[model samples]
Target: MLILHRRVQLLQMTLVDCTREKFSKYEQLLNDAGQKPEFWDVVVITARDDSQKSIFDYQISLKKQRHEVPSFVKYIVISDPPGVKVGSGGSTLHCLEYLANNFGQHSLSQWKVLIIHAGGFSQRFPSQSVLGKVFLTLPCSKYPIQMLEALLMMYISIPGKMNYGVFIAASDVIFLFNEKGNWDFRVPGFVAIAHPASLKLAKNHGVFILEDMISPWGKYRSDPSSPAMVATPKCFLHKQTAEVLKHKDSYLPTVPI
Candidate 1:
């Protein structure tokens, strides 16, 4: 199951649209960027809770790409605080705070946000109940998982139009690159990163290694047919989610897998 979080108050939304529409916007935004190819900052929230030795090498890897990391890419590390354990959900909270502090004030007019981490998604497979069995599909329209994707599009579609948006891609994704640089935005489509520890793809371990930085803004261009969307900002977990689960959850609730 996939889950994305967003607030309606943050963006003046429209009826949800599909990938083609968003790609058009991505193109238009680039066109509108004052004649020169534009770029946005990239933020990398590395879940480095483990005391591994290659962490520094990972930083060097990104910096070396400084020449190729795209003018808009800004790699950031949200390392575990001292001895915090990986997968504790602390990384997610800290990642959020770091974004609020660092990119909070950017023009954000033509940028989009991408969070690629090395972790498995929290697989919340619902169980049987009086309602027979609960199917765990993410609601793309007014659903639990896609809300954040829609919110992010709204924010970047109309800068100064949206508040905040985050799109977390599972760490296992290889981030295949195309010189053409095409990204189709569809929330609730990918898996959510379950654990917080990060791994560089260059390492070649069973672990994932993220290789690309996606553009954060300018994905959708057409006006959505639906009226501005209302932010749900719903809590995903039950009353005792924390007590039931030993790990610290996303400061926000997470739908049980």
Candidate 2:
């Protein structure tokens, strides 16, 4: 699920305006200096407790080779201390504490944050085990770009309007959408993007049960100018069996085979 915070109270600026100003300043700097400035205020990459050094080494290699690694952006690697295996959630908490202690809460509150959870050794794709999955080269890209670069490109437009709130994302999956399309991020509370998938596919991922079974795709296709349809989720089930989904009253058929 993709969740976006509406605003940050400390900044006292609308997310959209804050985001725009950030990009505007970056663009001006890039044009003047002929090099990219720090695009993100703080980029925290969570790593496994033992793999912290390896991740740091990988970044150094990328910079030495002059790849697409954005060295300009301030990146901090946070891992579980000592014997504790805090997992993703714990690592994030450790990051917050580190920031508060080092940068102070007041200063940290004003900065835009991007947290990437990419700590696991890619056992399924063992070739990426050393460098991790985030550095895996994509075959579909026109030019050579690693998974990290591709993820950054996908979110390049989102930060401009965002306030001091954090943007958290996983490194494994990529969501494709129209870059120029109108996307509303001003909605209050957590906003998750949903995509249509077959029942078999849904079993392996999270499925949202909406209030109604009516399909909104018909209206969306018929009138492109209309506002995007929003649904009220009644419940969300993760990795549920096909039989369980079929029995749910609000469960609607997904994409057909």
- Point out where model 1 deviates above 4 Å: 1-17, 27-42, 49-70, 81-88, 96-116, 119-160, 163-228, 231-235, 238-257
Predicted structure with the largest TM-score when compared to the true one: 2
Show the colliding residue pairs in model 2: 15-161, 19-160, 19-161, 20-160
Task: Tell me each candidate's TM-score.
Answer: 0.33, 0.71
Which digits, one per residue and each the tens of the lDDT, describe model 2 over residues 1-257?
12112222322343334444534543354345455543567777767665654665567466536635554567776666667577766777787788889889875558877777777767798887767777778874446667776566656655664556567777777654433445644465656677556788888888888776566655543443343456778888889999988787434555232
Give the alpha carbon lDDT tens digit for every residue of 1-257 in model 1: 12112322122232223333553554455345355332224444444443321453364354345431223445555555565355536666666666667667452323444554432223442231111111122353332422222322332333222233445544433221111222233333332221212222212222221221111111111211222221222223323333332342222123221
TM-score of 2: 0.71
lDDT of each: 0.35, 0.63
